[model samples]
Target chain A: DVKVTQSSRYLVKRTGEKVFLECVQDMDHENMFWYRQDPGLGLRLIYFSYDVKMKEKGDIPEGYSVSREKKERFSLILESASTNQTSMYLCASSPVAGKRTNEKLFFGSGTQLSVL
Target chain B: DQQVKQNSPSLSVQEGRISILNCDYTNSMFDYFLWYKKYPAEGPTFLISISSIKDKNEDGRFTVFLNKSAKHLSLHIVPSQPGDSAVYFCAAKRADTGTASKLTFGTGTRLQVTL
Candidate 1:
């Protein structure tokens, strides 16, 4: 079974602070993603990394960035945490199964971020 | 624009009954569809998926039916149990987007099963 681990399950930060949410996948998947889930917005992609040191902006990438220094780890960074940024953040990974991209994505438990 | 939509925000069903959750997509480019179930504090887990080439896919008690012409799909769970209560999200993607592509997701439908 594939395992995706988030470094923190819950985090609290003051406004204007810097915040980091880390995720690690054991399966060495080629693709990693960061998403934020809001009450009515569902899951909106923030950023995704297809390979080490390669990143792309998703639908909702403002005020957020990502790092993929290694194949197994992906990190989401908030330049300046704001109250509106408080939400549940999820990390997901999918392997490039041969030439065909994997359809199934395995997700982490999610980190609930509270910005006060 | 919301490419994918889960019109029903919530649904309630009794144990041993059949629960049908519906989803629709506006984009014609979407060729693959998927369903995910999520609990309150946990991330959404992949449930099942159907490709444009196939109309139906079944796994255990869950069966997903797709209508390519209508751009819609439905997930049916028979003999629903209490553990089935969760938020079910309908997602879709265009297979042409390659490995870095992301799936477009609907707002999600919360399913509650009563004993």
Candidate 2:
């Protein structure tokens, strides 16, 4: 079984504050992703890292950034938290595609961020 | 544009009945499809998947049927139980896009099972 752990399940921050959401996966997958889920909009990708120090912007990358200093850990950073940034954030990891197994994401429990 | 769409926002079914959740995609390039189940306060879990080459894939009580011509797929759960209640999301991906490619997801459908 794969375990993806989020550092915090719930977090609260004031407007203009810096916030960080951390994720760690035990399986050492090469690809890591960050996504935000909103009602009626579903899950939108924020950022993803294919390898250490390599990152790419996803559909909703504004106001957010990510870090992948190590294979097992990926971190999402909010430069300046705002009320609108409050939402559930999810982290997922998967092996490089084209392997014998199909591409399937293993996700963390998710962190609910509240910006006041 | 929303490449993948789960038209039904919600569905209700009774225990021991069959629940069918539908999803459609506009991109013909999508060669692989997946279904995920998400519980409140938790991340979505991979349920089942079907490739474009196959029409149906079954696992336990869950079965996914795909129609390549229509670019649509449906997940059917038989003998639905209370534990089956959750938000179901349909996702699609292009296999040739490589490892860094992300899956396009639909808005999701909330399924409720009542006894």
Candidate 3:
């Protein structure tokens, strides 16, 4: 079984503060992703890393950034936390099963962030 | 644009009955579809998936049916149990890009089962 662990399950921060959400995977998957879930918006990708030191912006990358210094860890950084950033954040990983049509993502529990 | 949509927000069923959760996608390029179940405070877990080449995939008591022409898919759970209660999300990916597969997900449907 694959295990994905999040650094914090719940977090609270004040407006204008910087925040970090971390994720680690035991399977050494090559791809890692960060997503935010809202009521009507579902899961929107924030950022993703395909390899160490390589990152790409997803559809909703604004206000968010990512770090992949090592193969097993990925981190999401918020430059300035705000009420709008308060939501459930999820982390996921998948092996480079193939370029297309074959990757299965495994997800971590998720972090519920509250910005006041 | 919302590429994927799960119209029903919630559904309720009795034990031993069949529960069907529907999902629709607007993108024609989507070639792979997946279903995930999530409990409160937990991450969504991979349930089942189907490729464009196949229309139906079954696992245990869960069966997923895909209608490519209509851009719709449904997950049916037979003899639904209380343990099946959770939020189910429908997700799809284009798989056109190399290395990274970005998934588009639906809002999700919450399933509640009662005795």
Candidate 4:
């Protein structure tokens, strides 16, 4: 079974503080993604990495950045946290694109971040 | 521009009854659709999927029906159980595209099953 692990389950930060959410996958998948889930708004993509050192912006990427230094790890960075940034963060991984078998994503438990 | 939409924000059903959740998409280019179930504080999990080539797909008590002409799809859960209560999200993707092939998701619908 594939395992996607998140570094933190709950985090509290003050306004304007820097925050980092880490994710690691053991399946050696090539595609990793970051998403934020908010009430009524649902889950919106923040950023995604297709390969080491490669990154792409999603629907709502403002005030957020991502890092992919190695294949197993992907990190989401909040430039300066704000109260509005408080939400649940999810990380997912999938096999390399273009393969029909790689359609589904395996997700981590998620990180709940609170910005006060 | 929201490509995918789940108009209904919430639905309530009794256990052992049928629960129907609907989704619609405006993008005609999407050929693949998926449903995901999520519990509070947990990541969404893959529930079921349907390809444009087929109108219906079923797995156990869950079934998905797609209408290509209407650009609409629905997920039906028969004999619903209380444990099935959660938020359901509908997603669509263009199977032929590679660069921007990420799935576009709907806002989601919360379902409650009571005894």
TM-score of candidate 1 versus the correct structure, residues matched by position: 0.97
Q: Across the candidates, what are chain A's individual TM-scores?
A: 0.96, 0.97, 0.95, 0.97
Q: Order of all candidates by DockQ, from best down to worst?
A: 2, 3, 1, 4
Better of 3 and 4 by TM-score: 3
TM-score of 3: 0.97
In angstroms, how far off is B76's CA in candidate 2?
A: 0.4
Error of 3 at B60 (Å): 1.0
DockQ of 1: 0.69
Output the TM-score of candidate 4: 0.95
lDDT of 2 by residue, B42-76 (tens): 89999999989999999999999999999889999
Best by DockQ: 2
lDDT of 4 by residue, B1-115 (tens): 8889999999999999999999999999999999999988778899999989999999999999999999999999998999999999998987664643477789999999999
Root-mean-square deviation of each candidate, in angstroms? 1.2, 1.0, 1.4, 1.5
The regions of model 1 sitting more than 4 angstroms off are A97-101
Give all TM-scores, in the order shown.
Answer: 0.97, 0.97, 0.97, 0.95
Worst 10 residues of 3 chain A by lDDT: A96-105
Better of 1 and 4 by lDDT: 1
Tens-digit lDDT string for candidate 1 (A28-99): 899999999887778898999999999999999999989999999999999999999999999999987444
- Write one digit per residue (lDDT tens) for candidate 2, span A33-114: 9999989999899999999999999989999989999999999999999999999999999988766444799889999999
Q: Kindly give the stretch of ten consecutive residues in candidate 2 chain A with the minimal lDDT sum.
A: A94-103
Model 1, residue A43: what's the lDDT? 88
